[model samples]
Each structure stands twice: as structure tokens, then as C-alpha cells.
Target: MKITIAEYLLKRLKEVNVEHMFGVPGDYNLGFLDYV
Candidate 1:
């Protein structure tokens, strides 16, 4: 099975038990933030 970048990150977060993430919105981070 193939996993997308977003899926991979979410899976990793779950493994680490990350419930929330914080960050300010920026041009570069917008795309990544949107995925989260």
C-alpha cells in the first residue's frame, strides 16, 4: 500500500499520541497547515 505525505504524518502523530499542533499561518506553512 502507498501512503500520502499527509497520511504518513498523521500516522506518525498518532503513534506519538499528538492530539494538537500549534503554529502561526504563513505563506510557506499554509499548504502544510492545510493538510493538518
Candidate 2:
């Protein structure tokens, strides 16, 4: 299974009890934002 860098970071953030994440989405990050 392959995952994006955003997914790996989101997973890590989730582990730390993070329910919300904020960022300035760019063209490259838009794909990752879809999952969030």
C-alpha cells in the first residue's frame, strides 16, 4: 500500500490526539487535502 506524505503526517498527528490541522494548500498539497 502506498500513501502520500500528507497521509503519514496526518496519521502521526492523529496519534497525538490531533483532530484538526490547518495549512495553506498549494497545487501539490491539494491532492492530500482531499483526504483531510
Screening candidate 2 with a backbone cut-off below 3 angstroms (N, C-alpha, C), the clashing residue pairs are none
Give the candidate number with the greatest TM-score. Answer: 1
Models, CA RMSD each: 1.8, 1.7
Put down candidate 1 lDDT per residue, 1-36, tens digits, no spaces. Answer: 997787789789999999998889998777777678
Candidate 2: list runs displaced more than 4 Å.
Answer: none
Cα lDDT, all candidates: 0.84, 0.86
lDDT by residue for model 2 (1-36), tens:
998787898889889999877789899888888878
Best by lDDT: 2
Name every residue pair that clashes in candidate 1. Answer: none
lDDT of 1 at 28: 78
Let me know the TM-score candidate 1 reaches against the reference structure: 0.60
